[model samples]
Target: MADRLRSIAFAIFFYGLSVPIVLGTPVAALLGTSFMRGYCIAWARLGVWSARHILGIRMRVEGQRAAGPALYPAKHQAMLETMAIAAMLDAPAIVMKRELARIPLWGWAARRYGVIVVDRAANARALRQMMREAQAALGEGRSVLIFPEGTRVAPGETPPVRSGFAGLYRALALPVVPIALDSGQVWPRRGPKRPGTVTFRFGAPIAPGLARADIEARVHAGINALEP
Candidate 1:
């Protein structure tokens, strides 16, 4: 209960500060393109920093940054991992849930950073939009991250990635890098949260030949193989 209160308090505080930060993104974009990448991910760094300092969570990252930008297919245990990676990765482009864009500060800031948002229920339009935005981001030499599971999974539960993921891979034709972690066990997905180490291990990039039918299965196996 103490841990939960701390985590919740930190989250609410972060959200409170985020109101003005969201509107300032447009101003940052207009300042210069150099400010663009940093502007996109700065709030993420704040959230991650607060997680570590205020809530006492630590993060470990594996795998080196390769030459070309690739797509990250990560397991969604808790939302903290995404914010942590936002600060850690080199100018990463995010593919996120469409509803997030509707939030007061986060949504506007995310769009300014070129984070792709998709309405999972609107299959065709959403996939097309995600691919289009992803291609543009890759062309600009940025990495894109997506959660194939499409939603959060509780500890010990399996995340069955939707077919929408395979379609995104096939359409984008970009390298898919799988990130496996046991973050949910530490963060506990908003229930009985505890401060501890959450490790993020990056697996090898999936080759182009990895077919659609096999993509989700491959990602699932990789995430399951991580430490429990």
Candidate 2:
């Protein structure tokens, strides 16, 4: 109960503090998109700091952060990994649902930051658009991060990855860096966050041109290392 309260308080505090920064995202965009992107990354770090001091939730990354741009398909267990990964990576273009890119302030900031928004209902067209956006990001030397599962699942659950992940792999022809984490054990999809260290284990980059089945199987094994 105490930890829950602390977690809630930290969220409120962080949101309150970020309101001004989020509001000014457009202004920063006018100067350069990197301004807002850097701010957002810094904001993610702040959230991590609050999680540690206020909620007693720590982070333990098991592998070295990817140095250059690559296609990153990560486990989707909780929001904690989202924040932590964004903070740890360099010039990341996070692929997300279109709905999130519609929220007023955040949406504006995301656009300026070059976040790749996908319309899941649009099928192949969406994949094509995402491929274009992802290629553009990679061309700019930025890492592209996608949650292959499309949505969050419980820590022990493993859902079939959306086909869009394969689309990116096929289109970009870039090595896929699969990352696994147990963030859901600490920060769940719905519920109070528990206090613990979230571990993100990054697997070796898989060369491009593998069959879809093989890529999916390898990614599944890599991301589910934490599953019992």
Show where candidate 2 strays beyond 4 Å: none
lDDT of 2 at 18: 84
63: Cα error in model 1, Å:
3.1
Model 1 gets an lDDT of 0.77
Which tens-of-lDDT digit does each residue in 87-188 have in candidate 1?
A: 767668888888988887667767777888888686676678888988888788888888888888876777678777787787777777788877787777
Instruction: Please give the TM-score that candidate 2 achieves against the real structure.
Output: 0.95
Clashes of 1: 0
User: Measured by C-alpha RMSD in angstroms, how accurate is candidate 1?
Assistant: 2.3
Work out the TM-score per prediction. Answer: 0.88, 0.95
**Each model's Cα RMSD:** 2.3, 1.3
Clashes of 2: 0
